[model samples]
Target: MILTTCAACAAPLAHDAPRCVRCHTRYCNKTCQHDHWRRGHKQMCKKIHRGGNAEQYHADKKYKEAVAVAVEACADDTNGEEDFSTLRAAINYMGSLIQLQRSEEAKALYRKTLPVARRVLGESHEMTLGMRTNYAMAFCADPAATLDDLREALTILEETARTARRVFGGAHPSTRNIEGGLRQARARFALRELLGQAVPGELAPPEPQLAAAATPFAAASAIAGHLGMDPQEANAAIEELSELKARDPEAFAELMQAALSGEGADAGDQDP
Candidate 1:
């Protein structure tokens, strides 16, 4: 539910309590409003506005808080246990962590519980399949994930999806979910490949003299050396990037930003 208490003091507001003029964050009185603004709301106001105002923003925050609490409880309850219940809790916990963008935490949980889950539940079991699906998803959720990471995720999803289809059939929910994850992983892998190709070869030049000169040819040679690519392949990629930038500056900028920051690669394809 959306938080209705005063933003500053958590006091219940009257039906007509004053609200921030911009973000419409409710306050018990003018003093509380001013205090909240001074304390932190000044910085949060624009974010609140962008997040669909105070009600939606606070509601989302509240939901995430509840998920966090649940995750902690699951960790406590499932620790050192190797039963079905523990496996279930671990899967749910990993999903919550992924939702929270805590990819490292989710990955840790997966590594810890996956072996036990496979042994106890068997590979074709629905729970085991679900856990595998979520683990692959954790890779895509990681903002720092590289091309190799995406490739790993795609590989896992492909194998899991095949197993799910054979065990549960294509019409089953488990198979469908795994298939969906596979599709997303495939797309992310392809996109990452394209972005990798577009990346400037100058990131790691070869010869010290060539590296110092800052030329695309030198950069391509360096990239070829580092990535074990043919120099011609790197040069071709640079040419493609140049043509793409010239043809569509905005699209090129977006792709470049995605490649550099490792953003927009999140699959968000986990089954609830």
Candidate 2:
């Protein structure tokens, strides 16, 4: 979640909280804002703006903290500690990396530690199993992960689920957890496959002429075909699009540009 508290005192803000006009860093009142500015925001305001505003800057800061904690935990685990507590801490730290969308970093850590974990904790140990589960999850958690990555994750989950059921029995919590992970992986794979089928070849930006020639209803119908939506849902989407275009023409124009360019809408252009 994004930080919603004052920059100085960490107090929750009211609807009309005072904020820095430059970078939009919020505070409970002008006093807190001034205190924060004198303390640090003066030097940090431009940096925060460059780092995608206050919320994203704070989130990136927390991700760095998690990275630090994970590194320390892993270092501690490496220093002659084979106990469950240390191992679990290391595993959980890696999980925090994945949860914070640092999947590549999480995967690197998993590769480095999995062998050691198996040697020290054994294959069926809960810590080892948890590490394996999280490693598989990282494969699919990356935003840029492809269909092959999803397949790899599914394969790992299937094998892990089978092992958990055999070793821990069906009613065991570990078994249940692995089973749940397997189910989710399967669902993700299926959904990805369905979408791939919808657009058989590599997806290219819509042709300008085709887009211009198509009526809104016709465009909606085509989109519905690709997304497996019904006619009513397509109509509803068109209505929503119409409302958006009417309410915020600039935003609507930006959305169109993004669609044409095959890029995402700029988050910086959005209201904080």
Candidate 3:
């Protein structure tokens, strides 16, 4: 069976009438829909039609028409030079569409909306970055986000956090929040490092490879023996004690415990 009345205005509609590209509502004619959108229907377009009550009818009908028009205008590449307000309106409408479970339509809207957001808000503006963040999150929700994309986003976010810290302060909420996220991403990258540990030149051999790797006591004794100087130099004395600790596990444990216990000791009483 074919219906003939417009779903929106209830005016007579053709059976094969072209429908709203967004909400899929049939219209009597393009003129009726256009006037409804421009005059009164624009505000309610993001809503789904559920009832015929006077208020519901008006709100749903107008909003649907308005959204359809906005979506079309936004998607029209020919109108790529539209003003910021129009672009923002389209972005907002698309968000509403997404909430209505119109994911495909919302994605199309986002694609067009992002460029305008970048242009009108400027590359570094808060609004622009927010839009970019929203777009990234949307992509992340997809089952297809590759590890490479996440890595790239991690790098971008790290730079963004650094810029925020330089512009604001390290403690600023934006900088701190982004810094926290960057820290997590860094921890994830550390796993990659662990995997490549077996590769040559990756992990340096433990401290013996370091020139002064020996206990302070051994280093001091070696230096004293070579230089003919008293091992009374503070560094030399520390080296000598370090060697003592290395030769006796019990002595090293005692020293470590004492150091930790004195963590809050007064500066004047602190041991070098």
Candidate 4:
């Protein structure tokens, strides 16, 4: 939920806020956790540890469970109350979704909350900025993320990193986190450029020339005949992929994913 504030005492929590090992509760430190334990968590903690608290259980780790909880919580209308904790819960649940590799769902959550966050927290507020970070990072979650997607992510990170430095100072935790995100985005961008695979398009030329045959079977036979005739060339082409894998593992993996999706004929094309 925009973890700028501590979960226990409402104090500002830095980037490295300590968390309860068992339930993953964030705290400013041992004192806050201890105080919270005395307040009521002494029992709540036990319930979570014993798996009796479904909310706590869902909130901590499971992907599908977290999605269910977030969906249910978001369904509750706070009726435009700015201070409602349910909104925060929704935002935090998006983070959990992203953490668990449910990026598509996280993207949907960010799209919904980004406008609301801007209205409630203002554009430059920490919570809004955090959402921006989450939105940008979400684009990178899919294994089939395109070059355009990575570039879009990089653009958002670059702007977010710059604004974070200006508002929070370079040394601030938020600024540092954005900077790290920028680095990863850059790496993805570079990989896309360097690897430039060809994703197939609708306009792909006819397969080695089944183009001018009278019937489907004739074309199929012609192609089969050529396959027997040019077995060496086919073997060479297949080995090229292995060479690519040995040379650059990351790009090769990206290419493999794209190829498996039948996108290899025009993967090199970038989005406008």
Candidate 5:
């Protein structure tokens, strides 16, 4: 026989009571019944507590539980294969759970997630990188993730930015923005590490409006440096690029092809 329990408290409930009147939990007694509804369990409680196809509700619940279980299972293994999609879902849902102030459960989720992220992404992929960024936020969410944890998270972000810059390009949006952030996080971590305190504005805040924001000219300058060219040469190449845009616009539709193809200032370079 299946034991029915209160959705809210997980206590055993009476077979007859479908709706918890007090806490809106499925319950066995008038007290559980009255307490469920009487304690201001009107809106969200009612929705979660009642009126669904039993089999389907159970199935959906089971599916989410399975996902949670898989997340834990993966997290538990010291050396597990990368499961980026599952890690992404776990990060998102765990964030939501944290926002709801479900701290214990959220921490458990994070524990499982962090190891999987480290193992699978090898501390580099954007997903793992993103979670590193999120850890400080999780601390901000709960205020209990020790100062050390936040510092470690920021360290990971710095590494992430470096990897992005090297693997992608200085001009690529992710590389540019995240590298900038890594610089900031490094500065902050340095201060806190040395001085044992957070300094204001030490961490470079992410660009608020990434889409319309102008590309980082400094990155272009850096690329020029990396390629052993002066800023003027870079500008000239960019000017040549503008001319290319006018003549063969479609060739450089989504990106500045000169940068991507590394044909900077090469007169021989053609769109086709």
Candidate 6:
């Protein structure tokens, strides 16, 4: 039998005594429910009531209101420890913002959540690592994000992907998600440079060490096929990878390490 626990306090609950009407998160009693509401659920009620599947809630792309709801509810963190449930609600809200192309807000929430997650959940905790991946994806997805922003996003995704693979192994979905994000970040950053859309100085110049690694974007072809990106875009990404190998061997090597265990990466990546 599945044991159900209260969403707020994690106390075991009776079979069907009480649950929030909108979200249906269970609670042990009215007191816990009230406390959770005052802390966050009160705000979540209307957002969840937006009345459709998770995808439908964002159909109109109006996430500002839902974000506001999370912000207001998440504000009452009187308990010294960060409230995981409220924080998770905030993340979901931020995801909606990102889905709607509201990058600034999504990035802001990502910044806010990372440190708390690191502190409360530890850096290597699956949840913390997942947050890191989400944060990087949010930044990389933004058209307005800078060249420097791509650098930071890729760095985070690379390290997080490596760590997730080490911890959860290659089969876990989290590990797979990080791998996919790394591929996308690389493609986006490379494409931007290939198109001359980014500032030249923001990227490093080719280095001697990278001369040995200049194949560039072994992942782009697969990405192009999977995402239906233009073939030329994929080729440009490969050229960009070669440039990265020339410009910054360390970054190139990191990408290889991050990707080594997934997507049938070549055995040569093992050395990088």
1-272 per-residue lDDT for model 2 (tens digits): 46678888989888888877767889998888777776656545655786788888788878777776866666685645455566666687777788676889888878877887898978887778888899888875665566788798899888888888888899999889888777666655554453354345534446753442133222333343333344335444444445666798776556444443424423432223
**Over 4 Å off, model 4:** 1-81, 197-272
For all predicted structures, in order, the TM-scores are 0.59, 0.55, 0.32, 0.49, 0.33, 0.50
State the local distance difference test value for candidate 6.
Answer: 0.62
Model 5 accuracy (lDDT, Cα): 0.49
True-vs-predicted CA distance for residue 111, candidate 3, Å: 4.5
Report clashes for each candidate as comma-separated counts: 1, 0, 9, 12, 11, 6
Write one digit per residue (lDDT tens) for candidate 3, span 1-272: 24467755788877667654433455778876675555434323333232443345556656776776666566564445456656656655665564444545666766776777776766666545544444443333332333454465567666667677777788777666666656544433332222132122432225432222122222322333233334233334344445655698575445433332333323322211
**Prediction 2 TM-score vs. true:** 0.55
- Strongest candidate by TM-score: 1
Question: RMSD for each model, in Å, please?
Answer: 12.0, 11.7, 26.2, 20.1, 20.1, 18.9
Q: Report the C-alpha lDDT of model 5 over 120-154, residue by residue, as the tens digit.
A: 67766766666655554454344233346557656
| Best candidate (score: lDDT) | 1
The lDDT of each candidate is 0.68, 0.66, 0.48, 0.60, 0.49, 0.62
| Candidate that beats the other on TM-score, 1 or 6, i.e. the better one | 1
Candidate 1 C-alpha lDDT tens digits along 139-208: 8766567678878888989889889888878999989988887766665555445545655443433444
lDDT-wise, the better of 1 and 6 is 1
Candidate 2 vs 6: which has more TM-score:
2
- Model 6 pairs whose backbones collide: 205-247, 206-246, 206-247, 207-246, 216-241, 216-242
TM-score of 3: 0.32
lDDT of 4 at 122: 80
What is model 3's C-alpha RMSD? 26.2
Ranking by lDDT: 1, 2, 6, 4, 5, 3
Model 6 alpha-carbon drift over 4 Å, by segment: 1-81, 197-272
